[model samples]
Target: MNNFFPAVLRLIAKLVILAIAVIAVAVIVFWTPGKPADELAERWATPPSLFMDLHGMQVHIRDEGPRNDPEPVILLHGTSASLHTWEGWAEHLAQHRRVIRMDLPGFGLTGPHPREDYHITAYSEFVIALADSLQIDKFVLAGNSLGGRIAWTTAAVAPERVTRLILVDPSGGYPLPPKSMPLAFHVAQLPVLGQLMDYMLPRFMVRNSLENVYANPDLVTDELVDLYYDMARREGNRQALRQRFQQDDNGHEQAIIRSLEQPTLILWGAQDRLIPVANGYEYARDVRNSELVVFPDLGHIPQEEDPDQSLQPVLNFLGLAEQR
Candidate 1:
């Protein structure tokens, strides 16, 4: 018994040391701040044409279209996505109505806000502040996936400001959870290993993510990979994305969707393994005077996947095109 006591004591000491090391590692990782968003923003550095201002933090947004256009549309992208998601749609829509798209804090070149929560309500406030800054009274709002969730919430809370609502595979409001959520979601859900992702993101990680969302892998060009990979390296962007994934707003937001009053158009990829097609129907039922359009071969992003087929339905809903 006396001999066994010495062995047990050695094991206890080893475990105590190991525990301290683990905690120390966690504290350092969590508290350590990251670099600025410049590296991430480099590939996206085009001819200077963005407006940056501190609305809590510096926001990067593109406001286009003729000043005289009455009905404007604000576009929002999904998780780990940037304002460029609407590049194709923006080129077309800006000609007709005022089109505004942005890199939401944490995801794109805009980076994360100083605020810790990054809640839906926090984002709702930022959008309103932007409208006030632009001196606009009311306009149409559209978003894909996570952005779509915010669009619905913004309309519900501030219906007076939102003229029309458009959603593409938006999360949070719909009952059906994402079918094959990104690998980041599972990692971000973990306690320890997930924290490592925010700090050290490989270029391949970005490539894998792009391929996963895209319906056709061949469509993901080297340039596209470079853009996404570089943008993710921006100082605060990765951490913001990490935290955004960790924050769960699922249960609290169904009531927000129920409160929506504005006319809405729900567009989805029928082959979307990310957020299932059931969400399109769920949103269509919730909003007043809503319509749902599902593309057979499209995945998560119908706008990017098949714009020619997708845009016609959207234009039809907005009454921008003459009825057939």
Candidate 2:
């Protein structure tokens, strides 16, 4: 035993030195700033359309509804997505009920804050704070993927504010990444490699990512591509995404969703490439009153790609089908 002790100590010292070198390199790479895309400036020239003071930062949101509408509805988008995910639903829902959608911190126009916490609880607090700023007390909550996880967490923490729950391909009960994925996701996970990739922001990379998300890649238009590219180039967004990916919540959301008893709607693209369709059933079985709606032949983003079919089910779930 004594003969081997010296060798073990030497190995430990070598490992420590290697770890320090790796960390030092990471720090240097992380500190360097990325050059913003040129055409991006033309597109994102304006400040966000809606900015509400929340947790010491300006939150960007889109609010729509008639003046007298009573039930306020909030929409949360998935990872790497902004309020645009709810564009079709918001446009239709705003007619009857007050609809509010925001870019969760680290995404879209709002980007990141001074504090870089992106855990579900942190996001939940921001959701409530946004609702407070808009004077919304009770509302239906709908979220997709990561957004779905945040919505459920908010309802579990503050049940009074969330009366109904809608989870479109929500992620928590399962542990599989959807087959169809966005490029931003992989790039954001690397410590400094992501920053370097962002600086190289190849237009083809953006197009390929958009192509992968939809069942029909042709759906990606020039103007819409510009929106995503421009917003991605905004100074703090890439860094914010990196910080958010590092945030962790100790799997408490699974138990909370299983105990959920709200009038819940679970919508999924049967062919969802990201987050998969099985996740829909996992939550359906957990939530006693949840209904699962699956759309065949669609990819990850059912709301954005197939709004006509997607909005109908969401409207029915909210009981706004007849009103609109």
Candidate 3:
């Protein structure tokens, strides 16, 4: 009996070693290195894409529609997302209003901030600086998720510059934890895994993150995966993401949000597991001049998930519904 037990232990040890080997092989095979922003820009940056020198960074921006429009719309994207998230809305909105979207520093073709400062304040300042560079005095500011937080912060700090605010599932209203966080975000919070992410990222990780945010997983196409994966792998972006997450304050600036004076439009995805619909209610309650709209069928990104449906409320708010 003693001999049999020893043999079984040996077999178990061998099986464990084999499993480890398999995992190591998979890791090596799928090892993804970061790509230079120039390489990614070829596929992502098209005609409207302008690489302007803003605050010492070659900011990748798309300025469309009639430049004569007095009040243009500036669209900002969420964490790990580029301006492309606003493509559907921007395309339609550009027909009437001047529409501008950019890859915020630490994401997309814009790459990372030279200072590596990813605080909400830094982002707010960047928005103001971008406006100055564009020579735009005042406009409607709209953002989603992290971008939404920046949008409101900018309005609070520079109230005169923002005529209207559209916050979609913004993260700065309440200090509520997500019911279900994306695997990538979870890893980014871990010391070890987050560091490893800087060097090696798997395609599945990007795909899973996108699927997690969308109400419909099927909408996450291979092309969509390619865009996200490519942007995530941009040089210095992964590290910037890590820095941003580290510096993130989960709604410590509720005072700033409550202080917003611009006419605000709050949009939330009812199916959002990241930031619940309750936060949306809090925004409507806190912001004196705000309207809240919840999309029952959408998740974290209602604008991206259903731009047509989500844009209707925004159009009405902008008084462009009659034009439609």
- How do the predictions measure up, each by TM-score? 0.85, 0.83, 0.93
RMSD of each: 4.1, 6.1, 2.9
Residue pairs that clash (backbone atoms under 3 angstroms), model 2: 178-273, 178-274, 178-275, 179-273, 180-273
Model 1, position 1: C-alpha lDDT score:
83
Q: Better model by TM-score, 2 or 3? A: 3
Which lDDT tens digits does candidate 1 get at residues 240-323? Answer: 776876675666566677778778888988889888888778778776678888888888987876667778877887777763
Residue ranges of candidate 2 with Cα displaced over 4 Å: 1-48, 250-252
Instruction: Report the C-alpha lDDT of model 2 over 211-243, residue by residue, as the tens digit.
Output: 777878888998778677666666688777777
Q: Model 3 over residues 70-164: C-alpha lDDT tens digits?
A: 98999999999999999989989999999999999999999999989899899999999999989999999999999999999899999999999
Q: What's the residue-level lDDT of 307 in candidate 3?
A: 89
Full-model lDDT for every candidate: 0.76, 0.77, 0.91
Score candidate 1 by TM-score against the native.
0.85
Ranked candidates, highest TM-score first? 3, 1, 2
